[model samples]
Target: MSRPLKERKLLVVAVVSHAIVHICELSFPALQIMVAAEILHNPAAYQKLGFAYFVATLVFGAMALPAGFLVDRIGQRRVLILFLFGAAASMILVGTAQSYLMLVLSLGLMGGFIGLYHPAGASLLSLATRKQGAAMGIHGVGGNFGLAISPLLASGLAAWLGWRLAFAGLGLLPLFCGLWVLVDRSIKVELKAAPEDTDNLDRPDPKLFLLPLLVLFLMATLNGMCYRGFSAFLPAFFKLKIPAGTIPLVSGLVQAGSFTTLVLIAGMVSQFLGGKLADRFVKEKVFTAIFLLCAPFLFLLSRLEGIALLLSATAFAFLYFANQPVSNALLPNYVPRLMRGRLYGWFFFANFGAGSVMSWIAGTVAEKFSLAIIFEILAAIAALTGILGFLLVRVSRPDKKPEV
Candidate 1:
C-alpha cells in the first residue's frame, strides 16, 4: 500500500481500537440493571450495585493521572496494549464473579484498565494530526459508537445467554484486538510531549495555567456529574417508567434496551455534529449552547413518561454527548503540547471522579425518594455547566488560531 494509505489505515485501527475500549468501559452500566436483578435478587440492591459501580468509576477517574504520567514515559501504543489486555481480563473476572465483593473488585480493576484510554488516546490523536478538533470529534464518535451499541448488545446477550456469558462473550473482542496490537508491526505510532515553547521566555509565568485549569476543572466536574448520574440509571429509569404492555413486540428487557439504544444513537449523531461545530466555530460558545439546550430536555425528562420520556431522554443525551468533543478539542488549545496527558489526567479526574460521587448520590436519592428527582438535580447541574462554559470563555484564550 501507499504510504499515506497505510498511515490512514493505521489511524483507523487506532480509532476503532479506541471504540472497543469504550465498549468495555461502558458494558457494566449497560448490564448493571440486569446483573442487579439476577445476582443481588432484590430491588433495593441496585442502590448497592450503584455504589459498587461508583467504586469502579472512582478508580477509573482516580487512576488517570498516573496513567497519564505513564503514557509520557512509555509510548501510547504500549499503554493501549496494556489497557486492552487488562480490560479483557477484568471483564472475564466480572463475568465469573460468584459474589458481590468479587464483582466489585473485578469492576474496580476494569475501571483501572479503562482509565488508561482517554488521556493516552487523546494525546496520541492530537500528536497524530494538526486538525485536533476534527480528530477529537472522530475519536469521540468512536467512543459513542461503543456507548451506543453496548447496552443493546449486552442486553441481548443477557437475554440469550445470561449476564455472565454476556460479559465473557464481549471480552473476546478486546482480547483479539490486544493480540493484534501486540503483533502488528505495520502499526508504528508513538507520541511524546514537545518541549516547552521558548518563544515566551520573557513572559514566563509559572501560574499561567491556574485560572484556565480551574475553569476547566469546574466545567469538567459539573458536566461529568450530570452525565454520569443521568446515564448510570437510565435503564432502570426506563424500566420503571415505561408501563407494562406499552410495546408488545418485545420483552421488557428489550424495550428498555431499545430506549437506551435510541438515546445513544442520538448521542452518536451529536458527537459527529459537535465535532464539525468544534472545528468550525468557537468551541467554548458551542459548549455553552449545548449545555444550555440540555437543561430543558433534562427537566422534561423528569416530568415526561412513555414516548415523551424517550424523546426527551434522547434530546438530553444528544446535548450531553455533544459537549464531549468540543470540551476535549478545546483543552489542548490552552495547555502545552507536552503536558497534554497530565492536563487530560486532571481534567478527567474531575470528570469521572466527581461523576462517581454523583452516581452514588443519585442512587441514594432514588432509594430514599424517587428517580425523577435525580433528573431535576441534573438539570440544575447542566445550567451550572452552561454558566461555567461562559466563564471559561471569558477567562481563557486559545494559544493558536483555529486549524480550519
Candidate 2:
C-alpha cells in the first residue's frame, strides 16, 4: 500500500477498535434500568446496578497496565485481536448470565478483555501515522461516537430481540472487527515496533517528571469519577426526572436512553473542537477551563428537568468530552517517548480504576438522597479536578526538559 493508503487503513481499524471498546464500556449503563427491572426487582434497583458497573469498570481500568506490557511483548495487532475475541466471548457470557453475580462477573470479564484496546490501538496510531494529532483526534471521535450510539443500539436491540439478544448483538460487532483485523494484511506490517526500540538517549530523568505526573494523575482520578458517575447515572436521572412524552422510547427500554443518546451526540461534535483547541492552546490551561466549565453545567443538570435538563446535559457532554484531547496531551508533555506507553497505562488506571468506585458511591448517594444529588457531588468533583489542573500548571515545565 502507498503510505497515505496505509495510514488511512490503519486509522480505519484503530477508529473501529476504539469505538468497540467504548461501546463495551458504556453498554452496562445504557441497559442498567432494563437489567434492574428483570434482575433486582427492587425499588433501589438503580443503586443495586452500580456494583456490577463498578466491577466491570474496575477491571477495565485496572488491566490497562498489564495489557500495555503484553502489547509491547507480542505487538499491538496481536493484543487487539485478543481483545476482540475475548470481549466477544465475555459479552456472549453476559447475554447468557443466569443471576446478578453471573451478570457482574461476565461484565467484568468483558471489561478485562476490552481494556487491552487502548494501549494496543493508541500506540499503533502514534507509530504508523505521521500526523499523530489528527489520527488521535479521529480515534477520540470514534470513541465519542460509540458512547453516543451505545444507549440507542443496546436499548433498541433489547426492545426488539430482548436484552439477551441486545448483548449478543453487540458481541457480533467485536467478533466481526476481530475477524477483519485478523485477516487484514496491512495491520501486521503497520503496527510497527514498540516505543522502547526508538528511545532517545537524552530522555529526562523519571524523578523530575514525578510531581507533574502525580498532579495529572490526581486530576485524572477526579475527572474519571466525574465522567463515569455522571455518564452512568444521567440516563437513570433522565428516566426519573424527565416528564413523560418528552422523548420517545426505544420500545420498553425507556425515553431516557433516547435522551442519553442525543446528549452524548453533542460530545461527538465537541471532539473536533477539542482537538483544535488542544493544538492551539496550553494544554493544562485548556484542561483547567474544561473541567471548571463542566461544574456549572453539572449543577444546572442537578436542578433542571425535562427540556431544560436535556439542554443542561448537552452542555455538560460538550464540555466533558472536549477534555479527552487536552488530557491525553498532558502526559506526553511530561513523559519521555519510551516511558509514555507504560505511564499512559497507569494514567488510564487512575482515570478508570480509581474512578470506577464512583459508580458505587454515586449509587449509594442516589439511593440515600436523590439522583440530583449525584450531579451536585460531581459538580464539586469537577471543581476539584480544575483545581488540580492549576496545580499541574505550577509544577509542569512543558517547554524545558529537566537537566540530568
Candidate 3:
C-alpha cells in the first residue's frame, strides 16, 4: 500500500477510537439518572451514582500511564484493539447489570478499557502523520462529536429502548470498529525504530529539556483545571447569571443544556482551525496566545450578564478547546520517539487526574461565594497556563519535528 493511503487508514481508525473513548467516558452520566430511577428506584440515588462514576473516572486517569507502558512494550495497535474488545465487553456488562454494585463495577471496567485510548491512539497519530497538529485536531473533533452526541444518543436510546439497551447499543460502535481493524490488513500498528534517531540533531538535550517538561506538565494540569472546572459548572453558572426568565424566549430556548451543546459545536470548528494554525505557525507561540486570550474572555464571562455574558462564554469556549491540538503537537519536540507514549500518559494524567479535583473545588467555591467567582478562578488558571506557554516557547525548537 502507498504511504498516504496507510496514513489515511490509520487516521480513520484513530479518530473512531478517539470518539468511542469519549462516548464511553460520557455515556454513563447520560444514563446515570435512568439507572437511579429504574434500578435503584430512587431519584436521590443520583449522588451515589455520581460517586460511582467518580471512582470510575479515577480508574480512567490512573490507567493512562500503565496503558502507555503496555503500548511501549507490545504496540499501540494491539493495545487499542484490546481497548476495543475490553470496552465493548464492559459496556455490554453495563447493559446486563441487574444490581447497583454490578453497575458500578461495569462502569469501572468501562473506564479502564477506554482509558487506554489517549496514550495509544495519540502516539499512533503522531507516528502516522507529519501534520501532527492537524491530525490531533481532527482526532479532537472526533472526541467533540462524541461529547456532543453522547447525551442525546444515550438518552434517546434509553427513551426508545431502555438504559440497558442504550449502553449495550453504544458498545456496538467499538465492536464494529474493532472487527474492521482486525480484518483490514492496510492499517499498520507495529512500532518501528525511527531512522532519524541515528542523527544527533534530532535528539533533545536532557539538561535543557527537564525544566520545560516540568513547565509543560504544570501547564497541562492548569489547562485541565480550566477545562473540567469550567465545564462542570458552566450550565449552573449560565442558569445563575442568565436565569430562566432573563432573556424571555431566548432563556427558554437556549437554556443551560442547549447552550452547552452550542459551545461544543463551536469547539468543533475552533479545534480544526487551531490544528491548522498550529501546523502553520510556531505551535508554542500559538498555544501561548490562545491560553492568554482565554483569560480575558473568562474574565468577561464572570462580570457580564445577559447577552454579553453569553458572547463572552462562546469566546472562552472557542479559545479553550483551540489549545488542545497545539498542546498535543508540542510534546514531540521535547520527548524522544521511543518515550513519547509514556510522556503522553503522564501528560494526560496531569490533564485528567488533576483536573478531576477542580470540580469539587469549583463546587465549594460556588457554594461559599458565587458561580461568577468560578470564572475568575479559571481566568487566573488560564493566565498561569499562558505564562507557562511563554516559557515553553523559549525552550522549544520549532524548526524540527519528531520522527517515528
TM-scores, one per candidate? 0.93, 0.93, 0.84
Q: How accurate is candidate 1 locally (lDDT)?
A: 0.80
Clashing pairs in 2: none
Tell me the tens digit of each residue's lDDT in model 2 across 210-234: 7878988898888889988987898
lDDT, candidate 1, at 268: 83
Window of ten residues with lowest summed lDDT in model 3: 193-202
Q: All models: lDDT?
A: 0.80, 0.80, 0.76
- Rank order by TM-score, top first? 1, 2, 3
TM-score of 3: 0.84
Sliding window of 10 residues with minimal summed lDDT for model 1: 192-201
Candidate 3 clash pair list: none
Off by over 4 Å in 1: 1-7, 186-208, 398-403
Per-residue error at 154 for model 1, in Å? 0.3
Candidate 1: RMSD to truth: 2.5
